[model samples]
Target: MSATAVILQNRFSNDGATILSVAVDGRMVHESWNHTVSTNDARAQMIDAFLDLWNVYCEQGLVLYVSSRTVRNLLKEQQELFDGLLIRDTITGAMFRKTWDVCSASHHKQRREKRPLPSEIEKEPTPLVVVATDASKGKNSKTVGLSAVNSCGIIKTHEMELNSIFDAELSAINFALQQFGKNVKRLEVLTDSRQAIQYIQGRTSLQST
Candidate 1:
């Protein structure tokens, strides 16, 4: 069992064409493409490299870290191919993508310091600027009411003509963000709408009927 991280980056040729490169543990393990590859092609290439690495190193178990959400989703779709693999997304993957070669030098430091990945670290306590949002719509009415209240006793409301309560709930969240997002570096948003939360978290998509 080992912790292996992979990063996919775009390299520009002398002629200014974008090409894909794959880095494994901050080292350039694959970059043989001479021609530019499409986004899907690049993702395929990265997955191929990952599988190749896994084949060679899958002794006990392997935990893979990757930054690309699309790549992770593709791997998840092919359950049989990655049946025993543990995949995780991390900010360190994106950081390594940006500084592929340079990050290699830091590997020793990371090992010496026993540094943990950013995602592995615990997040700080919640900030004081917490906000709650809600939306109301009358039955068979197109008019929607949106409201946002913060912990500081400030209330903001808006009235709009929208088609669905889902849209209104989302708008209320957006309205809350606009009201306080700029002023605070960290803000906690609370909403009772599970569908809205799912859409916001990218777990589901919103479709207009």
Candidate 2:
């Protein structure tokens, strides 16, 4: 008999934090200060908000979208209110975790842009150079093999005395940076290590700032 459903999701973080907010139809309706309320207080607010919405739309269907298992169990305890309600994503933690997994499956590698030959240039500005670096660490190997290739077809490889992959990766990055002494303002270094990229970018930004 119910024609419309009020979609709801209770979003909160931590093991015992209060419900940060109740998203009704994708809009936050009732929100509590995070970690500032007791578990009892969280439940009370949830019940209050549900009852308020139910009073207005009880004739309509109720849909619950729960992303956390703890929050789902808490709501399940109120069987009287939860009866006849529709539920989606019953016991999943970390919303969008699966979606992000799918995203990475297809977006892991980026496409490289094509460049024109040096002879086809009319007025050449600053020479653009792109350096790609990578390291190989096989099992039972003590040394790391670091290699770098530039857009100008210049390739360099080094056997570093570093034992860990991180060390080898940093050495490869340094090799790329050392390719240009000065006057090369446009330099691009591509690597598979996200941690290295983040650290180098963060340090460079902090120094510039």
lDDT of 2 at 57: 57
lDDT of 2 by residue, 1-109 (tens): 4322222223234545332334444333443443434655655555566667667656666665544455557666775765566555542334333433332222221
* Total backbone collisions, model 2: 0
Clash pairs for candidate 1: none
TM-scores of all predicted structures: 0.38, 0.35
Clashes of 1: 0
Candidate 1 lDDT by residue in tens digits, 48-101:
767787776666445565446888877777756655676766544554454455
RMSD vs true structure, all candidates: 20.6, 19.1
- Give residue 179's error in model 1 in angstroms: 0.9
In model 2, what are the clashing residue pairs, if there are any? none
Q: Each model's C-alpha lDDT? A: 0.67, 0.56
lDDT over C-alpha atoms for residue 90 of model 2: 40
Q: What is the TM-score of candidate 2?
A: 0.35
